[model samples]
Target chain A: MGKLSKKEIERVASLARIKLDEEEKEKMASELGAVLDYIDKLKEVNTDGVEPIAHITGMENILRKDEPMKKPLEGQAADAAKLVKMAPDSKDNFVKVKAVFGE
Target chain B: MIKDNILIEGEKCTAASKILENYIAPYDATVISNLKQAGAVFLGKTNLDEFAMGATGENSAFGPALNPHDHTRAAGGSSSGSAAAVAADLAVYALGSDTGGSIRAPSAWCGVVGLKPTYGLVSRHGLIAMASSLDQIGPITKTVEDAAIVLNTIAGYDPMDSTSHNGELPDYTANLNKPVKGLKIAVPKEFFSKGLDGQVNNLTQAAIAKLESLGAHIDQVSLPMINFAIATYYIIVSSEVSANLARYDGIRYGRSANKAKSLLDAYLETRAEGLGAEVKRRIMLGTYALSAGYYDAYYLKAQKVRALIKRDFENIFEKYDVIVGPTMPYAAPKLGELGDSLSAYLADIYTAPVNLAGLPAISVPCGQVEVDGSKLPVGFQIIGKHFDEARILQVAHNFEKSRQ
Candidate 1:
């Protein structure tokens, strides 16, 4: 519906780097198509000469001085170790990832 | 209590996703830190629609949380478990995020009070981002006063969040008993049109009449642009999701695609295996909307429409102190019953616009509708101007008091 297709979904999923199986892909295609069809209703609205709002706060150029807040961690090093363990693969307090370039 | 996504240190913030099943929050979110400072005890995390993506808890990696009110009905979500727990007396109150009615819908369904504060009124530093521009963490509780208490503790400026507001925080409780006798309340006519169940319409309108009897002046107002809000909301939110969720590759925290063949495969595999069906659908929607060739057509257009929607609310607030409506079109449907994504999204018709407008709104249990001989709670939504949460809270607090 409204130009959304399986091929299109596959293309977008690749861009997001998400791997969808055939079943999930099919379901997503139909669901996304329906959603797009609904949002397509916006075409009727005239947003002529309107400035797009990125944030509702209307605040911009917020800058803060470089200052570090103190952390009085009880067993700080142990806590740091606990946090580091959150990584799926880790070694020596460093998170390990698959090689980027070399095989 | 906690939602699956918001980090609570020493607890797993799985976000009801298999991907983050074992992922303990490395640190507390800013709200958690504030709650801890306020002497709040920590409870275990609860379920939500995966990554706050769905209208019902059915999308959770853990499956839908059963409604405590009726076993067959839903505990309306993405804050499914938060609302469910508080409804079941598992916790006194809980926190929920409203991207598109996540907090308010469930609170309504559970017959409790949930407030979606004006955006940036609360710090977003440690809370996980669903849509950076739309998401606001608020409280789901048993009463409006408790909601105010939570907001008072959590609402303030945080340097860590660039979007955080710098306004002077007010004593939300101070206005809980203030006179609402002369306040102006506008009920948007668009909210009462088709797609709203007739029974819910009557219940919501009767609640408005009750308020009128209590001395608040009420009027029928029209927000012609309301029809465009959900469409605009989905576009902008999904677009932001595509960007925010990209950080979930297998490299760092959360579940990683194990024994990967390549880095590319790792990224795909982890996201593929970790996220649920609803999340993948939204991710694809976001990805396609933000794709190079279509960005202008979908994302930019949506933002422009967002300005119009926001302007509509601002114009209304010029004459009315608050806007009243049904929090949702109907009472919570039976669990596992919202058959499709589009159907579920439609359920948020009345609530999502507030998020798009970036205004403060609250859902309080107003009346019940009998469905198949069983009674379920319905909610009355009251929306206020930006940073004017105190006024709405006072309205809700007084209304709750008046009920007793």
Candidate 2:
């Protein structure tokens, strides 16, 4: 495993969308480096011709047929309103967010 | 019955993180719905490690859940509160999500019965996502019989969860009194290595000896690939966590940042302020593994090695009915005694392999080990083939009955 530099940590943090301070960055550089170094042991195993398993259960293509609306999906309008109301900013039953097109 | 905060719907599902501390669940988790249908009463939600990331309960944003045996020691975690509550007699039983020992470790540390069902046997719908592939919800209870009963109610398929198993399930509580006579049990040599505490090793070996005297055939087996289980588990778990947690981008319902200049800033700042340290660390590590240029080395390699670990168990199960061992390396440690996170991850060696293979395993109280003058509980783990909850539960049940 390569040394996890501060800049690399920052880059990963950016991809993850979690900001880290300089001190946290330094700590993660070492901590994540150690973890990645440990994970590097997988290289010892010969996985030649072995297919990687994404799901353990053999079930595949579990297709559910499109059925008619089952009693309007059970939730009352009050529940819908309450769920929509949970957002920090909302109006007219829609969650409000900053405009995608920046000014 | 108590439920871990990770299960969603009526109450707040904080998952022991500040980001969703006040987030109300919009729907009942499939397991919760199953329990309710069986007339199980809710005793309330319990604390856990943030996002079910840590092995010890210390990583909770609220605070670590204390061990029922010793107040200063940590209850084993991620499902810490549930195990502690059951051990402390605060609830009859509780539900906990296990994605690499979240249920078993805490149950072991707190001296309660915790069963991590085969993946997809219990639906993950409405449960907060930690690792999509390895996660399963199971019961934490005071007795193996109670764990069996709870499993009977909650084990089944759900249309809502595509990964849900549609296979038939046996009555988990039906064979509680079944004798272990003629049952073949394998004790993996790797689980009793030098890393195991001396007292814990003695107690676990004694427990196996007792089972042997009860007419069960016991033999030492080798699972050489077990050495790499923790490394593979962390890589896969972190990679999945980074993807699953991307849903909490401040737009939907979680904590939002104040006065964000742009959507990107809103996401970065909200997570910065809301997520706990361990959660962020996992996300960073996960993102790095799944990032450009490193995917093959970390995520993909881990998955292939995971196949080997799973194969080890499959080979053993071809002959043995179940594999038994100590659930943890040692008893619960003092609140902050786990030291660095790396050491904690390494301690999960025994339990991680079960998750990687998506097998059913239960941790039943074996006895206690004298640690620092305190008699802390040890867990005897019984692992079975995929979807063989009944066999493991029956073996555990007979063991529990024999103790009386």
Candidate 3:
């Protein structure tokens, strides 16, 4: 658990596909390091033979009907469309984007 | 009567009047029907962290919910408006979704009561999803008893929500008057460490002392991994958030791109434009964590860490009836003054582990912290074993009663 380096932050940003400015990368490095440093304190605890409990209630293998159920009407679709239509770049019932795979 | 008329008209204005003006309850969240039938007045949908992505209400597209206590300070969020409404007396209680301290953090900051029930206790059927496994719908109110009342109404099985529990419903309000004599309460040594604000720590200690006077046994317990809860929580939650939010592809629900040159363009453009910066950051982080080469390094390892965190709680609960801590590391920071998104994320450091461990936790206003003659409330967090909210409330209720 060493500190997060500039390269790692850039790698994370690349994987996540968000272009980060230099300042953001620097801030993230420091902030993430502090967080990891804090989390490292967990190593002090002895958790030998303790069964790791993902869910507290001890529930397992929740079974449901395999049959496809009727899709309920989601009232949000029309509203969301209206919202999208209001965006500055929307055109032809679709959202326009910057050119991909350059000309 | 005028207020009642306003509420009735508001309900009629939309199919579900739970959300404030901007948000349409795109789906029939169970809270809608419950609130309508309970005669709970609808006062428009309240603002929240977009898709509940934040701990402070500042993340909402609608606008940051101003803290009623101190307008300049933040109203702790994801459930920001809910807590604000309760504190301002705008609504008796507002429905809030808590994945990791969305409800509790704001409640603590806003001087209200917020409860995150045992993971499966409430149905999340219509509530917007943010990390399915960790999300639980809870109540934010001015009093512990009011929270219990709301919980009683909302807690039950829902076939529509796959993760809902089939367990028998417990009458949460019925235990409000239960005695707290000899109840074992553990105050984790790590919770009171150096970084915690002295004033907030003092207020929390006072609350614990009051509980002790009510015959509850107080002991200092150690939860060393409690510190890692936030980091492990962020990796797992953001990973799930990225996956869950993938459905909003301009085809189904939520804002979608209007004219897509291609299907892929529609997805990227729609998401890029529609989602706020924080949402984008989380999705990207989650996508990266779950990516092919990094999945084992980040997501899988985080899950293992999550297991270790849960084991810590289980071990503590074995000896103590409940664990207590300050809900937030500090009193609500001033609005526009919390500094960065990362700081806001750490605000949940005190609350996220409960979500990761799938336990029940509550935030009750124990006392107020005053800065420069302005006062904001500090909350005492009471966490209990799975499905053990009854005892948690009993202890919290005793503390509340003693304070009065």
Candidate 4:
């Protein structure tokens, strides 16, 4: 309902961990503000007693067995290796990144 | 063309983002597995909006997929390339994911048949996640029967996707031979409001009249909560998108920001550089909505409104077999015509609500309109109840048969 400031946009982008350049920041601030302002109409609807419908299908807590199928599991493992190998740097069968233990 | 976002095993599934340009799909999604078992060929992957974020074809990182009907216009997206490919006969048929209106909107613009199956009716295993709760992979084809054929191949239970329906699958083509006489159809008045183009409204009404003449009953229905659809859809989807897209940190896969000075920079810069403008925009908005202080106001409220939208459809389906309306507001806009994200978001007015309710809806070409010196196709959408795909397909097929 309230207007979004540039600072708020930047903070949200940071929370999302997606860096926005100066131009993108102002643009995003305005665009998201418009969308936010538009959806502000939700406040007009009195949802005081309504329960939130998270999924469209009424099914809840669908649990497949934890055991994996061998064929697809192997295939998925191979694909995971291939994806890992795609990173900028991979060593010893893993993607290598900047050392996590830095000052 | 190589894909920007489709998940073909070991193939690039960039999802039209700089971040995932190198991201190879880890395995075949459940739908892809079904298609493979049916002996479907691997035509090269087509284009889509980055992270499946926009309404117009203009948002793809690769560039807009041109409408075959009017080259100067968009192909309608985020299933832009799939619809255009089918329209142009570039592929026999193509798989498209409809989170909100991606499948139906593109089909309308391209003059094809696109079916967004009941949310859980089709498996979402291999399809790249857009908005988890709303996304469903469906088919875009040249005919209703063809759409039915593709649906038959892909619809079934897949343990891989916990959301996949465990119900018995039907031969979608089996009911195409059935007639739709005496079927009750409702036209939601909210869908025909002010912004609907006059030509489109006329054509849609004409299509309904023709349906009436075919022995089906048509009635104008009021769904008071219809006005809240776009607002509710954006809030819920953006919130989910923010959560789903967070896995794109540099370490796992996709294009990593090797230049990051620290692990946190890797997350920030990778997403910043890899994602497109519309995608980043949704992420920011979603993040803001889900933030601790604002969650109740935006995300939770949207879900409650979503419940109301579902109830509206439920009440209508209680009387009518299917609900009919125009798919998009009008024909495809000229490439780059909608200059802002809000306009594109608003453009999805008619299509998104069906997704929110998790029902099956199909866009069948009703007729064409001469606009801006070129002929553009108009689509009429028929929405059916959950898991009631057979009836809608039968209705659409009957309509298709009547026209011919």
**Per-prediction tally of clashes:** 1, 1, 16, 6
- Each model's chain A TM-score: 0.76, 0.81, 0.63, 0.76
Better of 3 and 4 by lDDT: 4
Query: Which runs of model 4 end up more than 4 angstroms from their true locations?
Result: A1-3, A65-80, B1-4
lDDT of 3 by residue, B164-251 (tens): 7887877888888888888899998988888799999999888888888888899998887777777777778888988877765545
What stretches of model 1 exceed 4 Å from their correct place?
A66-83
TM-score per model over all chains: 0.96, 0.97, 0.83, 0.96
Candidate 1 iRMSD in angstroms: 2.8
The candidate with the higher DockQ, 2 or 4, is: 4
Which scores higher on lDDT, 2 or 3? 2
What TM-score would candidate 1 get against the native? 0.96
RMSD of 3: 5.5
Write the number of the candidate with greater DockQ, choosing between 2 and 3. 2
Q: For model 2, how does the per-residue alpha-carbon lDDT over B119-226 read when each residue is reduced to its tens digit?
A: 899888778899989999999999998888888898898877889999778898787788999999999999988999999999999899999999999999999999
The lDDT of model 3 is 0.73
- Cα lDDT tens digits, model 1, B131-228, are 99999999999999999999999999876677889878899999899878989999889998899999999988888988898899999988999998
Evaluate every candidate with DockQ and list the scores: 0.60, 0.62, 0.19, 0.69
Error of 2 at B358 (Å): 0.2
DockQ order of candidates, best first?
4, 2, 1, 3
